[model samples]
Target: MTMAWGRSAAVGVGAGAAGVVAMTLVEKLEQRITGRPDSYVPARTLERLLGLAHARGRRAWLHNLAMHASQGAMLGALRGVMAGAGLRGPWASLMFFAVRLTNDQTFENASGVGAPPWTWPRDELVVDLAHKAVYAFATGVVADALAVRWGPGPGQVHAEEFPGRRRHIGPPPRA
Candidate 1:
């Protein structure tokens, strides 16, 4: 009856949605800035285009959603924790976002534009970074919301173990 892992699954779904939107917005922004239309689609949509759902049906959707959401949540959580820990600021934030932007290679490669050296590198980097940072932030927000119901907590038990068989009870009382 308990849906303990539901939170992570929900996070994946939300993250996938955000990924789709983020990719679209970035492509539009890039096109405007560079005056070139780049054939781009959201990351989540690409997975579907690649026939994820067609091949796996409900299980595929569930798997993709969970995987994407977890990745987004992890990135966001790291950024947040770093910021809160006083180990990061605007400069670090910029770098983090920039690092995430490199993930756009899939979109660019798909366009058949014949990648040119240093072609709009600065613009793409800037745009993708900003877009990804926002995507990461959005993913975190959704995860936090779901965490209220699904986040691991102080004394939560691992899903792999039965309550009574947990090591906390000293090796299940020697069976």
Candidate 2:
């Protein structure tokens, strides 16, 4: 049940891919209801970062998706590491929410394709938050589940080491 960093990272990327799929579905549903146009930040950010000219059609959407999906997968690896450290469940997800938001804003602002989040329209901000939360929670579910194989993380170990802490509920704790 010991944490394996390589395994955790690989599992995390898988979980993140799943999270991206879930987020896409949720976004599609919301778009249907709100008639919101697709956000172009991902594509724009990629284009700028790569020094590519703005794409006008399918290529633009393709760049957007590549950035979006790759970002989700990469971020998932970090979440996996968190799980390996015994950070799971809602609290872990909340921590991950901040990470995800920071990652997005950093890229967007750096690319000069987006304004500071505080300057965004309230509705736009809310929508972004909603999507990011979905990604975070979904990633948490998968990461946590995968981490179950590795047993409790470092945090869990520390907590369990408290005097009089419950033990012998199962096999020896790895964390």
* Strongest candidate by TM-score: 2
Residue by residue across 1-175, what tens digits does model 1's lDDT show?
Answer: 1333444454545543664466457657767977975322333444544544332555555554554444554455544443332223345455545444544444335543225325658866466555677675554444444454533432333332455544554322212
Residues 16-116 of candidate 2: C-alpha lDDT, one tens digit per residue = 99899989999999999999999888999999999999986899999989999999999999999888888999999999999999999998898899889
* TM-score for predicted model 2 compared with the true structure: 0.90
Clash list (residue pairs), candidate 2: none
lDDT of 1: 0.47
Q: What's the lDDT of the predicted structure labeled candidate 2?
A: 0.90
**How many clashing pairs does model 2 include?**
0
Query: Each model's C-alpha lDDT?
Result: 0.47, 0.90
